[model samples]
Target: MNRKQPIFYLCSDALGDTAEMVVKATMQQFAVDEVNIKRYHYIQTEEEIYALILDAQENGGIVAYTLVEPNLREVMKRSAIEHDVQAIDIIGPLMQAYIDTFNDSPKEMPGLQYELDAKYYNRIEAIDFAVKYDDGKNIGGLLAADIVLVGVSRTSKTPLSIYLAHKGIKVANLPLIPGIAPPSEIFTLQNTLIVGLTMDPNHLLKVRTERLKVIGLPNTTSYTEYEPVKSELNYGNMIMKQLMCPVINVSNKSIEEAAVEILGLMNKK
Candidate 1:
């Protein structure tokens, strides 16, 4: 299409996650910066398709769409034909394949992947709570969390907390920085809710080095060195022993796996 920089047009009736995902995955097969994206959401009228088609033709762009509404999808097809524009129906091909093979049809409703129930809202609330209390922020309201995680840097605390939040468990993570006292709630919270997270020193060094690189910071500091990381791990273990709470080792485990262990401990107490 566009000789200078190809344009990728994504159209959808709801949020364009599917079409965007298709575009992104396809782009990964080539170069990362080869194309520029133009997203069009909630295509409700034929006039919108006509206007978008005109722009695609002018830019020599390809339109990839996931319009589940039958009438709107037809309008998009007709407009692309009238404008001599290249169009890709991202969902239609897959849907047709399912229909042909299984002799089944979809209800063609938008946003069927989303839930709006009490559990769903609770997850949203937990995610908010996790974000609010991440890294010991907003710990003045310690009773709000279902679980409190303490860990040195690069122990997968934040990610594990988020995974638990998605399962409707409110989680708070406190950083175990040397010379910095964590929230006093760590001492007062019941052993059930207060747990320590640790990781192998070598893995912690690698993780912290990569983290520093990502933020454009130097790794010359003691944060990523083996000895300092080992010292931090030892300190965390001592605190865990003193508090007599569960200690979860997150080395070589996924966020989901770590959450499962944390949840099991929470259930026990």
Candidate 2:
């Protein structure tokens, strides 16, 4: 068996959860099979902090520490020395890079910049909400989405959503169910850039067939039959047409490629 590479995350109290989500998502994107991650809370005592470091060192993997408090910086430095593994302190490098790149020309913000921050934050929250719940009823959550995807089941919506999120673009993906009426607002969201994803019928059937078997569902040929798959694609296109959405055939594309196409459309819009 290939040895699992451990990644220790010693994060400040404020940055842990976000960091964990980002790192785990990145690992999945890289298709890493063996990874172990651990998070540490902000520490007060030297002994307690040192014990955490000791445990990470014994785990014999890379350590990534995010320290916001200057007081704990020395302890972290010492731990890195003792661990003899690849260590990265997140903020230090990021700040250094920012200073090196943008130190010369500083731009002043407008008086309303602070107010606009709340607007942008709300937009991001709405995008996340829509990505999680893409049903037509929750189209309100996708109001802030720059790109919205509509497709049949198992058409790579979720992975594409994550991919777009990593690029700082809010993506919302909704599935099309044939014979079932879609939510109302999806037909009226003219401000949103919508993309419909379609796949080859034979390929779609094969994938759904295997998926159903894996989940111990009845291997009904409904999803895999040629006419049913064709109807699903047609229904998805009809939904897009009613919404004035652009359609993309993603059957031959990777998730990253699909995300890139979606982003390009957003930029064009």
Candidate 3:
């Protein structure tokens, strides 16, 4: 028998996006109801809450909503019971207690203002390009980069790029396609430090095959055969050798370790 999966519909304009992303991240950690969780946002009024309740009822799962207003909270609680769904109002109790217990301490207001400014003062932008094509992207402006990474395709380039980027590195990755030759501009960028990433031939072939299938491409020998991978790696290594670039084998390295290694490389340079 299938277990009763608990689904929540969170509702808060201020906390909506961050809360939804948090729940989504948490869902991945759970084996139960991992795929069943969803979030609803921008719920400020009673009608909006009621609409979400109706939606959750048809699905027959828990309906967790949040509200800032006291009157709306009461309305939602009644609606939740009427819909026969488990409901959780995330804000009511916390707000009541906070109001009752806290004094008007305007002295801490400056610190709070400072904290808010510090938290979001330097949010990073999305990496518009995928990591598989990083070898082709230019990092000439990456002197602001906390760490830079270079590697051939499917060698965990995208994840590492995102990871280092999250750590405040304006990480620019260039994907190296063996025998295709890196563009001439890459050779001229002496200001930016580079690290070469390589992986085992067989493992790369397997990963490439899976990626090709997902993109509806043919898993042909030309794209992921052992010889082609080995040749590519050889060419990449030769290019790095000629350039006197430091190389790292990433087949066994975790994302954190790769980022750390890159940081060390940058520090040494």
Candidate 4:
């Protein structure tokens, strides 16, 4: 006879995403594979809780639940004990802790974090705007953008733009290639913050060299050579001087650090 896989019953009055996330995170600590997870969402009545407890008892499964209503939680606990089922309260202890520590009560609402509000819609719109105007694809975005990034290649422009968009700031980036004039719209911006990104020549050469290797291009290509890299940086610096925007040296900074600097500038503006 083969051993059956252990099942986990996730019960909730709402979408049950919170219990599912906790279950997934706990599974990472275990070595076992092929554990079954069954989700029961929008569970409201005592009869529904009894049915789920019966199912768990039959399958020798453990129940993990995020029940907000005291009546539903009491029924789940009583039935689980009566049927000899192991039940874990995912959020009940945390709620109690908050009440004990701060003497405050939760609203006992489910899926409040997932509510679609103005900030959520703004983030979605900003992310869409980032994708639509990425890499200088649409010059028109320059005028409407909250911040504009101008840099040579491999300065983390695209990732930075997406990160900023997550914070609900619309960002557009343009690559400052040597001898390629940027769009005329870049010069007319009055309200947008134009940020210049530059990297050390040696760091850029190493980065571009690795990039070429990953893409199966020759290391001898001008894109990775010292002279061409220096020329690109110099040209980028000249453009930044013309625009008189704040420049960020990304040679030793992380995306988060650079973002903090940019966000500070935005706050000051």
Candidate 5:
């Protein structure tokens, strides 16, 4: 473990995704690669809170927690104070602010944000739309798309499309195969935001080779070769140029990171 890396301890009485989201988004403010995230979910007992605080003391790390029950929340606060560790109550302060502002009380419910609301159902519909149109399969209904992503193989088109879909964006991803022209309607659609995703040829080759290996196929195909990957990238770039869409590189970036840029580009257009 790198000592320069900060150990972030996340605790919650429910699944710790919200706490983790807080930590990860805060960590992005800094330009660092080494962050050790330790998640302690379903933490209901005072004993569990104490034990985690002890671990945080031992590591000299910070704690980020979301505890709804007052007793359990106090236990975490006291334990962190006793252990002399920096503890961040991810939900408490905001919950208090909200309660005071609205003159209401905390419901003390754990994981209430995970309820299947209208937004969740919208994401489900978008996911289904992306799956139905993946790999340029259903080009006829692409006129209904909110965003169209075009890229050669392994440029993260599918994952990016799905991630955007989860945010209620109707996304369609088309694979850029050499010698095949893109859908004619894509050029005609004026309202849809068309994006061209690209990746480093070497990285694409490695990704394709690993994918082939996972599917029990040999890596000897042109799909996994450096020269062929480079040619594909060039051809894909030519097509993107013909479409006059914004090009984004996905190499060495996470889905969220690329989505941020994609959304930014979409907003500009």
Candidate 6:
């Protein structure tokens, strides 16, 4: 006989995001397909919890819940046991552990994790700022940015800027070309961290060559040539020296690794 599709019933006092995440992650560990995830959010009363447990039991679904209220959780537990349904508490054990270890009580509020507060708003604004000022589109963003990234092509400037921006740091990145002078505003920035990104010339050449192939362009262009790549690196190094900012060689660093280093430098400054 063919097996029935696996079903997960997610219950939460707020948006069912927490329970849904846990269910999805657990699903990844199994080779199951056609899995159904049903989210029941804003659960309040004991009747609602029992209803959800009954639904799960009828559908042969497992329940994963992040209910913050102790009474609601008790109802869910009891109903699941009475109805022979499997129920997993996503946050209760962790909350209990925190209470035991730290001798503290939780606020037990729902949707606190998804609060649209100042930090959330700031992160959104930073993301917009990163997009608007990306690739030196507007040099004026230099003065307003929390971090300014200057680098030659394929130096991970754009990715690093976006990563930092997601952490609520407004970042502006500018490409350093061989013959082009950077914006004058970059020279006069106050209270902004300027980071220079560089990569090994040979590695950059390989990356550029692959980029050309991916874009159906010829590798004969100066972009993929060793001499021009070396010149661009030399010019970038010179500009970094003139700016007197810290330089990061992104030759073997991932975006996460580079972002951590940049954050450390930011803390030091």
Best by TM-score: 5
Residue-level lDDT for 113 in candidate 1? 54
Report every candidate's CA lDDT.
0.83, 0.69, 0.66, 0.91, 0.89, 0.91
Q: With candidate 4 superimposed using the best TM-score fit, by how many Å does residue 53's alpha carbon deviate from the native?
A: 15
For model 2, residues 175-198, the per-residue Cα lDDT tens digits are 789878777766677677878888
Work out the TM-score per prediction.
0.66, 0.66, 0.59, 0.66, 0.75, 0.73
Q: Model 4 segments beyond 4 Å from truth?
A: 1-104
> Model 4 over residues 76-152: C-alpha lDDT tens digits?
99999999999999999999998999999788777776689999999999999999999999878898899999999
State in Å the error of residue 28, model 2: 6.7
Please tell me which predicted candidate would have the highest lDDT against the true structure: 4
**Full ranking by lDDT:** 4, 6, 5, 1, 2, 3
Q: 3 or 4, which is superior by lDDT?
A: 4
Q: lDDT, candidate 4, residue 1?
A: 11
- Give candidates' CA RMSD values in order: 5.2, 6.1, 6.5, 5.6, 4.4, 4.3
Candidate 3 structure quality by residue, lDDT tens digits, 36-99:
5566655567788788789778877665555555666688789989988677765456656776
* Full ranking by TM-score: 5, 6, 2, 4, 1, 3
Candidate 6, residues 1-269, lDDT tens digits: the string is 12778889999999899888888888889998657998899888888888888888888999999988998988888889999999999999999999999999989888898899999999999999999999999977887899999999999898899999999999999999877899888888879999999999999998888888899987788887898889999999999999999999998899999999999999999
Stretches of model 1 off by over 4 angstroms after superposition: 1-3, 78-86, 92-120, 136-148, 163-167, 177-203, 206-221, 237-269
Give the residue spans of candidate 3 off by over 4 A. 1-6, 29-34, 37-39, 50-60, 64-134, 137-147, 158-168, 180-193, 237-269
- CA displacement after TM-score superposition, residue 172 of candidate 2 (Å): 6.7
Model 2 backbone overlap count: 0
The RMSD (Cα, Å) of candidate 3 is 6.5
Ten contiguous residues with the weakest lDDT in model 3: 105-114
